[model samples]
Target: MLKKIRWMAVVLLTGLVMYPLPLMADHQGAGQNSTLVLEPTVVTAGRIKEKKSDITTNVTIYTREDLEASSIQDLSDLMLKEGFMVREYPNSTISVAIRGFSTDTHGNDLSSSVLILVNGRRAGTGNLAKISMDNVERVEIIRGPASVQYGASALGGVINVITRKGKGPFTASLEGTLGSWDYKKGTVSMSGAVSQFDFDVTGSKSSQGDYDTGSGSEYRNTGFDSKERFSFNGGFTFLPQNRVGISYSDYSGDHIGSPDYLSANDPDDYVNHGIKSYDVYYDGQTRDDFLFWNIRYFKGKDEYETHDGAMTPSRTYWRDTDSQGAQAQITAKWAVAQITAGWDWVDYEVSNSNTVAGKENTYENPAGFFMVKTKLLEDKLVLTGGGRYDEYEVTSDTGKVKEDDNWSFSCGAVYKITGELSVRANYAQAFKMPTADQLFMLTDYSAWGMGIWSGNENLKPESSETYEAGIDYTRGSLTGSLTYFHTDFEDRIAYKSIGGGVTQYTNVQGGTLDGVEGSLQLDIGAMFGWDWEIVPYGSFTTFLEYEDDETNEKFQYTPEWSAAYGMRVNHVEYGLNARLNFTHYGRHEITDYEGTGATTLGPDTVADFSVGKELFDMNKFGKIRLKGEINNLFDRDYALVQGYPSPGRTFYLGLNYTY
Candidate 1:
């Protein structure tokens, strides 16, 4: 896999130096500026809008234009191509980790240390399956502790999504996709503004049949997936400085198959899942724009049912989870200093039909935070400091309760050495509060045939201290950055298999991770006065020293080395775009499924490519475009986990029309 990827890189580089491309001008449509912005704007790092170059944390932003140029089918696709450290498991489960933390899937619990948010509010589950790329305006990712701004579960980082809002004149769009494995999908959306009211609405449905592996054989239990989704956002500006808005999102999946491990096919295992979420918010600003405030309330719920076996004696398991929260925040600025303060409350509950009656687990958390940012040395130097306090409680149906509290702090600084170069450094102390399931769940089931285990109510919250530094450069149409980060964890949680097929929860001494990430973008249209563009990005992560005094083994799932590099090319005049992506993961030493010895896996690389073109445009009828994408283009036979092979050589064709 490595050799293949290297050869492809050579070919790409060789072609770039020799190929001759035309110059194309950029267009941002009506009421939009054509000026090129090399650095994207971001909000996840500070809970406020700012240039990525101005933030002390390592941040990445993906704009709507970026999304439209990529072969993104879902959030996972976007992350994979962007070089984020995302883990993809069977049944399309997707999770992300920053600086080598929050990597655990926990069998789809979606309660990892990483946090996911939509419009500054927590999105339940953080399950990629529950996230759809519809009516999305932008995505910002912060790569490190964000507990000061986002509270618990942000120990690793945060993924903040911003949805589109109505502006300008009315517009409509339609999109459809057809692909290998009988895949089919369609989407429709509309956005417009009327007087003081604005609205955006979208809906989609999709389904796919079974897929074939690169070995020309079918993957068992990897049956089919079908889904439906709807989203709406509307706001009314009742006053010149105040606005009220409401948003709703719903997603449903039917008969999603859960394939067996190691190329094994199972015809009888599948699940049905659904999620519904709603948000109501108000935003107001005082005169002179010195003080800005926002208040919001949100609710989200998820349910799923799994079926095993084929005939009448089949068994079934089902679960329901609910999450709700509210927040109020104020930001005030004066001169070179800005202060932000906020308070929030969150609640989560989980229940299962297979568990004992009235055995539901519940968790409640309330938090407050204060942050300050200042500029010194004539705006060449920036400083940020923040702290948060979180109080949490866990309760079970049996009347048992546990209460705990923790405080987190962060400090960062950025220094500009020149007009085009800058350096940044940050330090943070973050903690992950124990989940209700971790503290109160008593249900036990066999894990990979290893043993039966139940949650431990006495477990303590996990904590970490992280340090990061980086350099950034932006000049004309060229932009590049490199960052290195390290993290040390304490009291990390783990589920251990004891004797006699019994497992128990325990605290590991902890672990340490260190890594580097880098990205580069060049606009050929401006560099050489051509109308083309190219962006090449890459990242590398590894554990410098893991394990503790009690164990010498490396942390599970911590690859010795992982790297991803990709390049995107575009010709604006011709409306042509193409992208090539490659990723490699080093070998991992993992405990065997049968509770025996360890096994070495991975050290694999995968590549993908996509191309798109505009077919035609009618003045009043809108513009139409065609796209083709191929995943696993090399047909490499590999697995993210032992016994689970990735799909191979799949193709997709799509059409999109916009007015």
Candidate 2:
């Protein structure tokens, strides 16, 4: 069986590396306004920089333009458009399910196993992986075990957010919106360079009333989310072969959570807590003809609070999270090969008040690791391999606990077939150590008497081995990628409540995921006075669970298939912008059939969208612009999660003026 599996992996890899092509074109992108496009671009793939084509892992990127056209209101709005991803928030919260591996289809859980970053810095949230886009430039999402690089949680991969930077002597833009459900939003940004030192700053605010479910209930979504943010990113070349840069960002926000099945009009609506965060980072690089060195340090803090009173059965919990870390690396490139070696360390501390216990408890975990990357075959064939050794030190407020050790590594290569096409393949072995709650939680009474449970010191970390292959093709006006990936997971850890508010997290053995994704874009030159951009995309995902009898079954919250189609048009001076998109999601199992949180068919989603725009040229020294958007344009009502039905027809109008 091992030999057969190995052979299949080799064949799949060969197919991608041997792509056929006659001609290819360049990809159109930003950064042309000023910054030189560096070779071997550094993308947030595994918290590491890599060439786009050389990336052998499963990943996705959403640029500023993509977000603008899609007009994503929040994380769910963004994930919904990425056909390869699955998102559901049964209780008006959101979670991510990538490549068929997911904890809950519901979005409310912050502990979804997906790690999130801002400007290469970590942010904190309890169960839900939440982020703000006040000054976001792009978001890169990588899937599969990332514990080797990002530390705890990242068992599912990582989401890295890159912020905006200055391009010229001075630049500024402002935006605001008014829409249904008493919605309103406003944003401002300014940036410029003085000498060789450049900087960018931004701030935004927004709010919305309850959206009527229009589902025969008085239920209205009562989410009023607002944020205030500021960030500065600057870098300067110090010596002939070195540069130093630094960034600092801060944010505070509050939002009223909408009840799952109730209308906003209810006087007894339960309010979910909101979050606040701050981050700081410093980076430096030194490169000579033969050797290179890079280093970075990051620190972040997150606090949570409720909008209404103190706490209750529904409030369930209260908490604070803080994370601090630093990493450094030294590498060299000789004629035959390029090599890299690095080290990283992080510390995480959480303080919480358990709902049932009503007693404050805390947990602290610290860890460290090392890794490397390389190449071979006269540079025509590239190969990379790295390993990480980390120790998890867990401590409780009451006493000391056990320690866990993990070793992880990845080996992959991409071969150039033609300048326009390339096929690549890689295999990785990784592991995820259990979280504090998974190993030390004490039973709590809640949720219709579901017995509460705690963690197990004797528990073992879950492990996985994944193999993937992909082909990338690019040509004038078009670019695309197709990938096939699979992972065999052992000892999946999950939190479960037996009944009566009591809960205990445990591990179940034997799981696997298989999926394929293909995305392509076509841009047409000026036609009918408009520049046209069209994209057709799709992804297929399925998870197999080895039941108690070791029989393969369906995993929860993972979709069988999903797809999307989009069209966009743009005109220069007149500033006419428009887009239309359609997305479809196949069936998914909500939870285990006989275990907890079970469901027959998790809700599927089919959405349609359209937006239009126009811009007014500068008026005297002031500029004015107008825009509009109509979502669920057809008034289609759907559910992104089981009980959490999405919004109905909604429209937005915006006006902005600048001096």
- The most accurate candidate by lDDT is 1
The TM-score between candidate 2 and the true structure equals 0.83
Per-residue lDDT of candidate 2, residues 56-104 (tens digit): 6656777787676545655556766665455444233456656664433
Question: What TM-score do all the candidates reach, one by one?
Answer: 0.91, 0.83
Alpha-carbon shift of residue 117 in model 1 (angstroms): 1.2
Reference-based lDDT, residue 474, model 2: 64
Query: Per-residue lDDT for 1-659 in model 1, tens only?
Result: 46534543553463344333212222212233245455567877877666676799988778898787655756777776654556676566667666666533332233668887889888776567677787789988888898888877787888888998887778899999998888898999999989999999999998888777777778766645778989999999888778899999998988787877643567778877888899999999877889989999999887777777674644477878788999999999888999999999988877777445867677788999998999999989999999999998888766679899999999999999997789999999888877655665655466456456667877888889999998887665556676778888888877787677777777777777666666655665554554577666555554555554357667666666666778788887788999888887877666676343548777888898889999998878899999999998999887666666778798989999989
Q: What is the lDDT of residue 641 in candidate 1?
A: 62
RMSD of each: 4.8, 5.9
- Estimate the overall C-alpha local distance difference test score of candidate 1: 0.77
Q: Give the best candidate by TM-score.
A: 1
